[model samples]
Target: MAAELMDGKLLAQEMKEELKAQVEELKSKGITPGLGVILVGDNPASKSYVTSKEKACERIGIFSDDTRLPDTITEEELLSHVDRMNRDDKIHGILVQLPLPKHIDEDKIINAISPDKDVDGFHPVSVGRMVLGQETFLPCTPHGCLKLLERYDVETEGAEVVVIGRSNIVGKPVANLLMRKDKPGNSTVTVCHTRTKKEDLLTHTKKADIIIVASGFPNTLTADMVKDGVVVIDVGINRVEDASRERGYRLIGDADFDSLKEKCSKITPVPGGVGPMTITMLLFNTVQSARNRLSK
Candidate 1:
């Protein structure tokens, strides 16, 4: 039997509907969830991502305050914008797009955002809180992955899970999340990076009941590397040239999707999979921040 396709686009739409209702409820309580977005450069990919996020905010009725700064802006100027947003009572969440100009210190910019409004969940305080399993905003992509598993009714508790890649963004955080004593967690996780010995990597993968590959390279996890009935989440999105497509390239994930689908019990596809959930979760975190503000 072919694997059950985990349609992230469908799930994201469903989640947006839920969040829209939540936003309306917040509005009734005299609080409109607001997000502050700062784009520091003209990088095309960053611009596209920012646009998508802003559109999502609109659809969900979250107020968005967007700032576009030239790449030539000084680091101090960037920090000042973050600080201004930090003090803005209406702005419940602050998001500074990553990969700023080379001159700016990315770490310093990330640190400047108040942890309470750090909806991106990249601040050191948020990361530490997450590591300690305290309630905090999670990195959107990894949080989206967990939502997929939970919604699909995947049995994660005590299951053997192998995560490929070690980037702070997806790999490390997701691994930590899976081992927590919570729903969609309590799984034994093994992370394989470029440095992991091939034999050891194979050993862990072959025994895993679930594999989440985000190595950012094509075919990093092949069908042969997993056991029967495994669930695979392919987080890597890479562009590969293909003359057959209109765009001259196709999007693919880290796993060998064509083959893995035949052998796995469930899998998420590339463009339609984890991609959609990321933005949805970002909206989620922003709304959550607004909800938190009501308690104060």
Candidate 2:
């Protein structure tokens, strides 16, 4: 039998409904949660992502501000924008879209956002707080992955979870989350990256009860590499050639879903899987930030 679908789209819709209600409550209290997105270049992918974020905010009754700058924008100018958002009382959350131009320092821009308003959770402060398991804003993608596991009722406590990819955003933070001593956490976590030997990758992944692949390469995880009855979460979003599609390409995950689904107990599809949850978590974080500011 095929594995059960994780259904991130459905879960995201449910979470959005909760956020919508919370937003209504906040509005009744005279606080409107606001998210500010700064897009520094003309990268098509970045633009599309930002557009999606804006629509999500509108759907959930949160206010959104979009700041678009040219590719030639200087680091100083970018910092200035971030400073403005930081001082804006109405803006509870600030997001600087990633893959900034080569001349700009990504870290500098990320650190510029106030920790309280760093809804993307990319700042060093947020990373440190998350490592300590504090109540700081969690990274959206990894947090969404955890939410997927919880919504699906997948066993995580004491389970061996092998996460492929070691980037600061998804892999590392996710490993930290799973290892935390919490209900949705407490899994024995092992993280693998490019330098890891093939044998080592297969060794850990094959024995894992849960596997999360976010390495960004399409079809990186093969069916044989995973053990039967495992729960697989493919976080990678890669665009590959597809002549049939209108866009001439399609989004795909790192795992070979067709083969892996047959052997796994549960799996998440690429387009509808972690993608929707990421945006939902952003709204969730923005709401939390607004609440924090209001309480202060």
Candidate 3:
């Protein structure tokens, strides 16, 4: 049988419904969870992402504060905006949309966001806490990947899992996350990066019961690399040229979905798979931040 499609759109909707109820409860206590998003430059993709987050916030009764700046904004000026958001009592979570203008220092900007309000979980403090297995805001994409595994009932306990890619965003955090002694964790994980030899990568992946690919390239995993009965969660979203499509391009995952589907027991599709989960998890962190604020 072909792999059972792990439907992320359906899962995200379910999560949003839960969040909606939580928001109603918070409102009764006169506390509204708020999210502040800072978008730099006019990148169409970034704008689309920010818009989706805003819509999601609206749906869940979370307040949205958006700041759209030009590519010419200075690093200092951008940091000022981040600082302002940090002090906004109503804003429980602050997210600086990534890939800021080339001139801006990403590390400095991420470090500027208060760890308590770092909903994106890119802040150095948050990343450190995650590495130490402490309670911190988990990065949205990685958290989403973990949640997908849990909701689908894929057993990770003692599972030999291979993670392709080692970037901070999806790969590094996820590799560390899955190795922790937690319900969705407790797996032996091997992370393959650019330095890993191709033969070695396939060797590890073939032995894996779960394969998570975040390498930003197409065909990073094929049937030959992963064995049958493996669970595949693809995090890459690369656009390839397509003549038939209206946009002249189509989105694709790292794995050769068509070829790998027949071999894997479960798989997540691009666009609808990890993408929606990422946004939903961001909302999750936002709500959690508000909840944490009350406890403090």
RMSD of 2: 0.9
Give me the overall lDDT of model 2. 0.94
Tens digits of per-residue lDDT, candidate 2, 1-296, equal: 59999999999999999999999999999999999999988899899999999999999999998899998989999999999999998999999999999999899889889998999999999999999988899999999999999999998999999999999889999999999998799999999999999999999999999999999888889899988899999999898999999999998999999999899999999899999999999999999998997798
TM-score of each: 0.99, 0.98, 0.98
Q: Who is ahead in lDDT, 1 or 2?
A: 1
Model 1 lDDT tens row, 1-296: 69999999999999999999999999999999999999987999899999999999999899999999999999999999999999999999999999988899999999999999989889999999999999999999999999999999999999999999999899999999999998999999999999999899999999999999999899999988889899999999999999999989999999999999999999999989999999999999999999999878
RMSD (Å) per prediction: 0.7, 0.9, 0.8
Model 3 pairs whose backbones collide = none
Per-candidate clashes come to: 0, 0, 0
lDDT, candidates in the order shown:
0.95, 0.94, 0.93
